[model samples]
Target: MSMRSPYPDVEIPEVSLTEFLFADGFGDRADAPAFLDGTTGDQLTFTEFHGLVEKIAGGLAARGIGKGDVVALFAPNLPQWAALFHGILRANATVTSANSMYTGGELAHQLTDSGATTLITVSPFLDRALAGATEAGLSADAVLTIDKAEGHDSLADLVSSGAPAPELTTTADDTAVLPYSSGTTGLAKGVILTHRNLVANLLQVHVMGSVTDQTKIMAFLPFFHIYGMTVMMNQGLHTRATVVTMPKFDLEQFLSITQKYAVDRLYIAPPVAVALAKHPIVDSYDLSCVKTIFSGAAPLDGELGRAVAKRLNCTVLQGYGMTELSPVSHCMPDDRGDLDLNSSGFALPNIECKLVDPESGKEVGVGERGELWVKGPNVMVGYLNNSDATDATKDADGYLHTGDIAVVDDEGVYSIVDRVKELIKYKGYQVPPAELEALLLTHDKIADTAVIGVKDAEGEEVPKAFVVKQASGADLTEDDVMAFVAEKVAPHKKVRVVEFIEQIPKSASGKILRKDLRARETEQA
Candidate 1:
C-alpha cells in the first residue's frame, strides 16, 4: 500500500511556467529587489527583472531561437542567469542548464545531447564554452557570452535587438528545462521537466516552507542543479523574496553575505552544514538574522544538524529529493524543527509514496527499509529521448521507482538509509561510477576499476576506486590515480581514495558488483 502525504493536495494550475510566475505581476513589490549579486552588490528589482525577461525573449526571438529550440546556459549563478532562464521559456524555447564546473568534453555531451542551437556563458568560461561548442559541432558564432567578449555576441547585444517579445506559445506540458542527471545508474541524461513539472513543484514546496515577500534567501548553491533551480531560484521568485546570489561558495563570503543581507532563509546541502557546525570562522559573523537553514541534496546527520541549530540558535531542517522528481518529495516544514533531523519530514502535498522491499517486491510496513517509489504531478514527464531509461525508472502505473532505500515511521516521516542505485553523491553532486570507470580505463596503468561511494573520516561521501593494476603499472601510486582523475573531472567527482586489488568483483553478466566492494569497505572499517 502506498502512503499518501499527510498534507492535503494542492491544486496545480495548467498554465505555462512563465505565465504562472510572471502573469500575476509583482504589484506593490514591483520595485523590490528580486535578486542581488552578493559579491558586487548589484541587484534587479521585480519590475526590472520582468522587463529584462521581455527584452531577452525578444533578443532570443530575433536570433532565430523560437518554439522548441533548446539554449544551453553554462554560466555561474548571476542575476542574469535567472532572467535568461525565464526568457528562454518566454520565447517558447527550452533551457538545458550545464554544470558550471564541467570540463569541455563533459559539457560537449550535454550540448550535443540536448541539441542546443546556441550556447550562452560568461567571459571567464569562454575557453571551455568554445571548446565544448566546437566539439559539439557548433561554430564560434553560435556562442554568446553573458558578459562582453571581444568577438562574440554579448547579453547586451541580444537586448539591443529591441525586437518585440514574441507570443508565449508554450503550454504547461511543453518541456521547459532539461537538467541532466544520472538517474538510478548510468551516464547523465537530460531529465525532461515540463512547465507543469516546474510549476507544480513550486506550488508543492510553497506549502511546506515559510517563505514570504519579507524573506531573504541566500543562494550559494549552483543554479544548474534541480535543488537550486526549484527550491531556491523559482521559489524565491514565486514568493517575491529577495535572493542573494553567489557565483561559488566560500566560507567567509557566505557568512559575510548572510550577515550583510540579513538573509533569513538559507538553502544549502549537507557540506555547508558541516562548515556551520565545525568551522571556527563561522563565529566571526553574526548569523542572528538567520531563521532557518534547510539542507537537501544528500542526507544530513541528525547530530550535526542539531549542533548547527544549537550553535546558531536557529532551525535546521532536512529534505530528500532526486532530479527525476523535479527534485523535492519529502522535507521538514519550517516550523517542524522538533522532528528528528535525520528523517526527511513529510512528503509534500500532491505526492503519494510507497516503500517496497526490493527483493520481496512487497510494500514494507513502517520501520522496514524499502525502495521509495513516488507518484506526483511534480514528477518529470520522462528522460529526454531515452525511452529505455524512462521505462526503467518510471513504471506504467505512474509511480517513479526512486532507487533510494528508505524507512518511514508511524508519523509518515521517512529517512533514507541506503541506495539501490550506484550513483554517488559527493557534496550534493551526482558522480556516476560508470563515467569514472570508463574514464579510468583510458589510463594504461589501470586494468580494471570499479568506483563506489565511501565515507571519509569527516563522514562525507567521496568516490573510492577499487582497481586491478596493469602488470606494467606496479609503480602506480594512489596519488597518481587521484591526480589523473582530478585533472579530468569536476572537483566533487574526483577519486579521493584508491586501492589496488588482484581482481574486481563482478557478476556473471560482467557487471561490477558494487555491493561486494561496499561490503569490503565495511569489513575494512
Candidate 2:
C-alpha cells in the first residue's frame, strides 16, 4: 500500500487576503524569529512578521491596490522583502519580483511590463529604482520603503499607522505571484504563479522533507528567485523553522552567519557550491550541525558535489526546477535513502512527470531521452502577456514541456543530460558555453566576445567567436581571442572561427542572442 492525497481532485490554494503564514504555523511560535538579516543583525519573529504584513496589506488596501492589481518588489533579501511580497498577496493582489541590481533601463521594462502600480524598494537602491520607475511613467500610488527608502515613509511607519488587515475572500486559482524567467528562446517573461500553484508546491516539499521545529536553515539565496521565495522563505515560515538570511553571497558573511546561527540546512547554487568545494574560508566555520546542502538553478558537476561533501561532511542534494513549475517539481533531499549525484530525484507527491520528443509532440518510450514534461497544481497559470508562448510550452494534454532534455532511470532518479535550448550545437552534439565565453572576453586586451556554433572543415558545426577589442591601448588579433576561448571551452566548442565585430548583441535581459550570432555567421559565409 502507498500513501496518497486525501483530496485528489482538490486544487492549489490562492491568496486569501486574511490569514498570514506565520499564524498558520502556530499561535505559540508567533514570536519565534523567522528571518535574521545577517547584514544588520535584524530579526523578525513570527508575530512581528504577521503584524507587519497585516499593516502593510491594510495600507495597500487603503491605496486601492486590491484584487488583480500588481505590486513590484525591487529590494535585496532583507527581512522586509518578504513582508512586502506576502503583504501584496495578502490583499489578493499580484506581485512582480525585480532584481535590486537592475539598471534603470532594466527595471523600467519590468515595471511597465507588469503594470505595477506600487513599487516597494529598500533605501540603498531607492534612487536607481525610483529613477527607473519614474522613467517608465510609473509613479507608484504607495511608495513604501524598506530600512532606508531615502528618508521617505518606511514600510515600518506605514505598518504602524495602518490598521489590521480586513478579511477578504479568494480562490485557489487566483494569481498571487509573478516571477520572471528567461525562457528557451525569449527575454524574461513573467511567470504567473497562482496561490494554489505556490501552496501546492510548498505543500509537496513540506510533505516530503523533514523540516522540524529544530530545523535551523541558512537563507543566502536571493528572495527574487522562485527557488528561494518558495523553499527558503515560505517553507521556513510554515515549518516554524528559524532562517538566517544573507542579502548577498559573501563568503566571509556566510561564514560569520553560520557561526552566529549555528545554521543547519544550507541552500545554494552551483557557483556557491564551487566556493564550498574549493574555498578555504569555509574551513573556519563550524559546520558539524549542517545536515544537508541543496543545490539547484544550474547544473552542479558531480566532481564538485563530491568535493564539497568530502570537505563539509554533509550530503549535497542537487534539486532541479525552473521558474515555471512554481520553482520545484523534484527534491533530491540529502536524507534521500539512496539517491546518486546528477540525479535530480523523482516527482514530488502530487506531480506527474513525463518525457516528450523535442521536435514532435509525442511522448517518448521509457528510458529514452526527451524533454522533461510536468503536470501538477504547481504549474503556473500562464505567461503574463504571451498566450502563444504559454500554449507552445504547455500542451493540450496539460503537461508543461520543459526545454531541458533528460533520461529517467528505472530507479526513479531523473538526471538532466542536456539543455535543448541553451545548447550551442556543434556538428550535432550541443555545447553549453556560457562562463567560457565570459572568461575569454576578460582576457588581457579583449573588449567583448560571443562564441556561437558554426560550420567547420568537415562541413560539421563548431564554435566560432565574434570579438571586439579595446581600441585605445592594444591591437588585439582574432588569433588572440580564439586562443583565449580555446583554453576555456571544450575542443568541439572551441572557437574555430573568429570575426571582428563592433558589438556582441544581447537581449534586454542580458542573455546573448546566439541565434542572431548564427545568422550573422551565415551571412558572412
Candidate 3:
C-alpha cells in the first residue's frame, strides 16, 4: 500500500518560478540581504536581486535568446549565480547546469546533447567553456564570460545595456532546467524538469519549515548539482533568506565563513557531517549560531549525525531524493527530538511513496525491504531525447522506480538500505561506470576496462577499475590508471583501486558481468 505524506496537500501557485519568487508580499523586507559573496563580502538585497534578474533577462532577450532557447550555466557557487539562473528563467529559456569541474569534452557532451546555443561561465572555467562551445558548433560570440575581461563580454555587459524584459511565454509543463542524471542505468541523460516540478518541490519543502526569511544559509554545495540548485539557492531566494555563497568546499573556509556570517542553516552532505563529528578543527570555531544542519546527497551515519549535532549544539537532519525527483522528496522535521536519525523522514507534503518487491513487482508490507517507488508532482517530466529510458523509469501510473531498496517502519519513516543500480556513490556524487569506462577507453594504455564500486578503508563506495592493458603498456602502474582518470573527471570520481585482468567477464549480449566480479570481491574481502 502507498503511504502519503502526513501533512495535508499544499496549494502550489501556478505562476512561473521568477514570478513566484518576485511576487508581492513574499518577504517582509525587500531591501534586506538576499545573497552575499563569502570570499569578498559582496551583497545583493532582495530588491536589487530582482531588478538585476529582470535586466539580465532583458539582456538575453535583446541578444535573441528567449523562449525555447537553451543556455548552459557552468560555474561554481557565487552570489551572482542566483541572479544569472533566475535571469535565464525570466527569459523563458532552459538553463542546463554543467559541473564546474567538467573537462572540455565532458562539458561538450552536455552542450551538444542539450542543444545549448549559449554558454555562460566564469573566467576560471573559460578555457573549457570555449572549447565546449566550439565542439557543440557554437561561435566565440556565443560564449558569455562572467568576468568582464578583454575580448570576452561578461554578465555585467549584458545587464548594463538595460534592455526591456521580454514577455514570458511558457506553460507550467514546459521544461525549465535540464540537469543531467545517470538514471538507474546507462550514461548520463538530461532530466526534463518542468517549471511546475520545481515550484511544487520548493513549496513542498517550504511547508515543511525547511527555509524562511530567518534562515541564513551557507551555499557551499555546488549549484551545478540539483540538491544545491533547489535546496540552497532556489529555496533561499524563494524565502528571501540571507545566503552566503562559497565557490567551493574547503573545510577551513567553510568554518570561517559560517562563523563570520552567523549562518544558521547549513545544507551539507554526509562527509561534512562526518568531519564535524570527528575533526578537531570544528571545536576551534564557535558554531553556536547554527540552528539546523540539513544533510542530503548521500546517506548519513546516524551515530555520526547525532554526534555532530551534540558537539555543535544544533539540530542535524537527513533527507533523501535524486535529480529525477526535483531532488527532495523526504526530509526530517526541524524539531528532531522524536525522529530516528537513520530514517530519511516522512515524504514531503504532496509525495506518495511505496515499497515494492523488485522481483515480484508487488507492494510490500511495512518493514519489508523492497525497492522504493515514489509518485509526486516533483517527478521529472521525462528524460530528454530518450523515450525508452523515460518509460523504463517512470510507469504509466506515474510512480517513479527509484532503484533504491528501502523499508518503512510502523511510523511511516523510510530508511534506504542499498541501490539496485550499478552507479557508485562517492560521498553522495553519482559516478556512472559507463561514463567512466567510455572515458577510459580513450586512454592510450587502456585496452579494456570495467569499473565498479568497492568499499574503501573509510567504508565509502569508490570506483575500482579492472583493466586490461595493451602489450605496449605493460609497465602501466595503478597510479597511472588513477591519474589518467583523475585528469578527465571530477575528484570524487577518481579511480581508487585498479586490478589487471586478462579477460573481462561479460554476457553473450555484451553486458558486463558485474555480479561475477562482485562475488569475487566478496571472496577477497
Candidate 4:
C-alpha cells in the first residue's frame, strides 16, 4: 500500500523560480544581506543581487542567447555564480551545472550530452572549459569567464552592459535546471527539473524546517550538486537567509566562517559529520553558533551523528533525497526534542512514499526492507532524451523508483538500509561503476576490467577495480592502473583499490555479476 505524508498539504505556486523567490515584497527589503564571501568578506544585499541577475540576463539576451538555450555553468561557490544562475533563468534559458573538479574529458561528455550552447566558468577553470567546449562543437566566443581573461568576456562586462531586459515568458513547466545523474544504472543523463519542481521543493523544505529571513547558513557544499543547489543556495535565497559562501570545503575555513557569521543552520554531507565527531580540530573553533546540522547526500552512522550532537550540544539530523526529486523529499522536523539519529525523517508535505519488493513489484508492509518509491510534485519531468530510462524509473502509477532499500517505522520515520543500484557513495558524491569501467577499458595495459565499491578502513565505500592484465602488460602495477583512471576523471571517481583477477564474472547477457563480487568480499571478511 502507498503511504502519504502526515503533514498538511502546502500550496505550491505555479510560477517561475525567480517570481517565487522574490514574491510578496521580499525583494523590496534592500538592506538585508543576501550573500557573503567567506574569505574576502564581500557582501551583496538583496537589491544589488537581484539587480545583477537582471543585468546579466539582459546581456545574455543581447548576445543572442535567450529562451530555450542551454548554458553550462562551471564555477565554484561564489556570489557571482548565484547571480549568473538566476540570470539564465531570467532569460528563460536552462542552466546545466558542471562539477568544478571535472577533467577535460569528463566535462566534454556533460557539455555534449546537455547540448550546451554557451559555457560560463572562472579564470582558473578556463583552460579545461575551453577545451571541453571546443570538443563539444562550441566556438571560442561561446566561452565566458567570471574573471577577466586575455581573450574572454568577463561576467562584469555582462553586468555592466546597458542592454534592456528580455521580456519574461517563462511557464511553470519550462525546464529550469538540467543537473545530470547516473540514476539506477549507466552513464550520466540530464535530470530535467522544471521551474515548478524546484519551487515546490523549496517551499516543501522551507515549511518543514521553519526557515525564515532570520536564518543564517553556510554554503560550503558545492553549488553544482543538487543538494547544495536546492537545499542551501535556492532555499536560503527564498527564505532571505544570510549565506556565507565558500569556494570549497576547508575545515578550518568552515569553522572560522561559522564562528564569524554566527551561522545557525549548517547543511553538510556525511564526511564533514565524521570530521566533526572525531577530529580534534573541531574543538578549536567556536561552533556554539550552529543550532542545527542537516546531513544528506550520504548515510551517517547513528553513533557518529550522536557523537557530533553531544559535543556541540545541538540537533544533528539527516535527510534523504536524490537528483530526480529536486534533491529533497524527506527531512527531520526542526522542533523535535527526541531524535532518532538513524532515521532519515518524515516525508515532506505533498510527498507519498512506498516500500516495494524489487523482485515481485509489490508494495511491502511497514518495518520491512524494500526499494523506495516516491511520488511528489517535486519529482522531475523525466530524464532528458532517454525515454527508456524514464519509463524504467517512474511507474505507470507515477511513483519514481529510488533504487534505495529503505524501511519505515510506526512513527513514519524512514531509514535507508542499502542501495539496490551499483552506484557508489564516495563521501556523498555518486561514483558510477559503469563510467569507471568504461574509462578503465581505454588503458593500454588493461585487457578486461570491472569496478566495484569496497569498504575502506573507515568503513566508507570507495571505488575498487578488479583487472585482467594483458600478457604484454605483466609489468603494470596497481599505481599505473589508478594513475591512468585519475587523469580522466574527478578526484572522487578515482580507483582507490586494485586487485588482479584472471576473469571478470558475467552473465550470458554480458552483465557484470556485481553480486558475486560482493559475496566474495563478504566471504573474505
Q: What is the per-residue lDDT of model 1 for residues 1-525, given as tens digits with 9 covering 90 to 100?
A: 799999999999999999999998899999999999999999999999999999999999999999989999999999999999999999999999999999998999999999999999999999899989999999999999999999999999999999989988999999999999999999999999999999999999999999999999999898999898899899999999999999999999999999999999999988999899999999899999999999999899999999999999999999999889998999999888889998999999999999999999999889999999999998989998899999999999899999999999999999999889999999989999999999999999999999999999888889999889999998999999999999988788899999999999999999999999999998988
lDDT of 3: 0.89
Q: Give all TM-scores, in the order shown.
A: 0.99, 0.81, 0.97, 0.98
lDDT of each: 0.94, 0.74, 0.89, 0.90
Write one digit per residue (lDDT tens) for candidate 3, span 162-244.
89988877668788899999988878899999889999999999877757787899999988899999999999888878889
> Which lDDT tens digits does candidate 4 get at residues 1-525?
788898888998779997887655555457788999999999999888888888999999988887889999999999899999999999889999999998877889899999899999999998899889988998988999998987888998887788977988888999999998998888888999999999999988977786778888888898999999999899878888888899999998888899988998899998899898889999999889989998999988888999999999889888899999998998888875366878789999999999999999888988999999999999999999999999999888789999999999888889999988999989988899999999898888889999999999998999999999988889999999999988889999999999999999999999999999889789988
| Best lDDT among the predictions, by candidate number | 1
Clashes of 4: 0
Clashes (backbone N, CA, C under 3 Å), per candidate, total: 0, 6, 0, 0
lDDT score, residue 309, model 4? 91
Candidate 2 residue lDDT tens string, 35-100: 888778889987888777878888778777788799889888877888888888777788999866
TM-score of 4: 0.98
- Per-residue error for 190 in candidate 4, Å, reads 0.5
| Candidate 2 residue spans exceeding 4 A from truth | 1-25, 140-142, 423-525
Candidate 1 is scored at a TM of 0.99
- Per TM-score, what order, best first? 1, 4, 3, 2
Regions of candidate 4 where Cα sits further than 4 Å from its true position = none
